[model samples]
Target: MKKLLFLVFALGSSCFLFAQDETVQALKKDAERTIQKDPNDTTSKTWKTGGFVGINAAQGSLSNWAAGGDKFSLAVNGNLSLYAFHKKNKHTWDNTLDINLGYINTTSLGSRKNDDRIDLLSKYGYAIGPKWNVGALFNFRSQLFKGYAYDDDGNRTFNSNFFSPAYVLLSPGVEWKPNNEFSAFISPATVRWTIVKNDSLAAVGAYGVDPGKHSRTEFGAFASLNYMKEINKMFSYKSRMDLYSNYLKNPKNIDVYWTNMINMKLTKFLTLTYSLDLIYDDDVKLFGENNDSPATQIKSMLGLGFLVKF
Candidate 1:
């Protein structure tokens, strides 16, 4: 449903962009002609729309090593992003709606599992000065496939064993681009409140009330910093960092996570990427006892990918 919503928006935007009148066409032609006279004298005068797609093959390790086989798993991921932008007079505005869908299936002969996830994102921003802008970020995620379980007696007791997890988040923040190559978003910290949650493990049998059964709100501050250096015209080096923290009120717990990614553009259509994710979770006391110790988990991935823009 979330994917379909974005597809509808993309189709509508395409139709709107191609349905421009003669007046709009004349203005665009004049603007193009004027810019052709002076290569350096470019001003905001029109609107444009575009999209991009990317695919990658990656390998990573799953924490806790479920299924008791191999800790490493192969992952294939893909993303689709669409944007519409307008430039008028001295101000420019850009709106991007993106959808990400990916699946990772792992197998070690007898032990196997599949994890599929989807994300829908929307961003809207307007330029205040040359490199200063403010934007809003909205995102949603849903888990499609979850595994099943059986009793110690080797009999199927529960027919539905897996739960679908989903989240809806809205973040309002400001972005500053000091130069054409460096940009960052900071302020109000984007707080992603969890509106929908379903976890089968938390709802089965006696341990059913463990914070994951129903809707619960998690508070977090979000920040993103990106730096890019252009190497020639089609290649560049990019680095991005994202931080999030969730404070659970009832459980009296705190969860902090950070993801850092570095990518080298091998060509106009390909990239080599490396990502590291670190998570720190505080001790959780359940029934007057903590299940596990307060520890840190690290996960990393390396992959080569292709990018396409339209």
Candidate 2:
């Protein structure tokens, strides 16, 4: 059944790419028509605003994380992003700035809890005379839900109180488009900062005592490269490689992690996304006691969701 599900997702992704091509083509044609109709109309402007909202529904199992479930469970996840921007001229070199905001919410592994996250991002870029474009990005993330806990002696305890964690990142990037259908992006020195962390369980002795309690800060850097190629007139191939590291304050510890995500559009409104998450960290105390060795873990998830543009 899982194999069959994967096959379906693959097919849907292929079809979605075809639809993207058609949409882009249609937009291009419209722009050309508008330009040709008024050769001397320098006062007219060309700008576009659009985004997508999606609803995702699926059934799967999660593992590796404490408080997570190993048994089959029904899950739902969704997100929405909207933006509007304008460029002075299509041929003239002009900078474009967009304020993009989005939110995502998903059910926990046991389906008894929920995780909600919100993102506020800004992207600014300018064409450095043609094939090269440079940009900077700022992103903020907030985890807006409570977590589960157990009694001091290991008995399960539940509550309704919740806290949120905040993370911020700054990235300066460059995009090179050798031609019309192919492009690549690299962000060499992106920095991420975590301003808040959860530690209630540790204070209560459910998780071992730690030097840092309540909220703490951590600093990290990441580098990633992404390439996309247009296949035929309707499909495109996308791939990315990333490396990240973090060093936490007191109770000194470090961690490194990587993530890979592949998404295929099934249509103008639907997309299939598959992700692999991996982490490797040095000895540390989790829930209060000392974890003896460096741990490496991998997690995977696949989901289908709708994408809408307005």
Candidate 3:
């Protein structure tokens, strides 16, 4: 009877120890799953970098054909966009660059530029909540080459050159980013500087600068919205809008800058793209057939091109 009792006690102790070991292993696995990071979390990425480049071209040649058109013509457009972002913990940094240039040549019109742009932006943020951040942003916008306004008589007037009307802004703001596809920044105090470094442009007070002055400064309320989304496997769209109200000048006449891009992917390297831009500034004047006034400017482009991604 004593030996049987000893055996029973040993078996019971072994069974209890085995069951406790299984429970511990299950708990460990559960903890690991809870703490493991998700691969698709955009906010937690350490670094992300990518860009796209595209070129579109068109040409036409006519001999003795009856069609009434330029004997020879060619048009080419090129664009580049780049971005880099870093995010970790509660801090984030983003930078972007964009450029576009286009030219058209024809027997009747010679060579002229159809599009020109350069834009750069950088932002830094510290997250205060799940969807809110305290942020500071810097932006610069200008053209790459000289721009001209041609009249009906084929006479051209020099309008702009590099740095002739560069726009720079620094904003301390609050940002809301609830998802990967949308972000908005709002600032009560934004500093804007318009620079016209060219002597000719400065003499005429181009782009709202004081006469004979190379730059103008403004304090304003500013807001910006950025949204990007992939509609499906073959279609995507992105847009940006900026609004500014100058407190030192005419606050009621707001300045606006808006851009939109739509892309349709045909293959891995081929795409059809459309881009639109709209700008309006109260201090800038546009010469029209009737009078010179502050008017909204619009530009749009559509083309099929080969795209390269990096």
The top-ranked prediction according to TM-score is 3
162-214 in candidate 1: lDDT tens per residue?
22334566677787878756667664545554332344434532122344455
Worst 10 residues of 3 by lDDT: 283-292
lDDT (CA) per prediction: 0.55, 0.51, 0.91
Task: Give the Cα RMSD of candidate 1.
Answer: 18.0
Best model per lDDT: 3
Ranking by lDDT: 3, 1, 2
Lowest summed lDDT across 10 adjacent residues in model 1 is found at 283-292
How good is model 2 by TM-score? 0.50
Which pairs in model 3 have colliding backbones?
none
Model 3 quality (TM-score): 0.84
Residue-wise C-alpha lDDT for candidate 3, range 1-310, written one tens digit per residue: 9999999999999999999999999999888885666888756449999988998788999999796889999988899989899898999998889999999999988899999999998989999999999989999999999999888777888889898899999999999999988999999999999999999989978889999999999999999999989899899888999999999988999999998988898999898989999999987775666435789999999988888878
- Alpha-carbon deviation at 106 in model 1, angstroms: 7.1
Model 1 residue 143 CA deviation in Å: 3.9
Which is the winner by lDDT between candidate 2 and candidate 3? Answer: 3
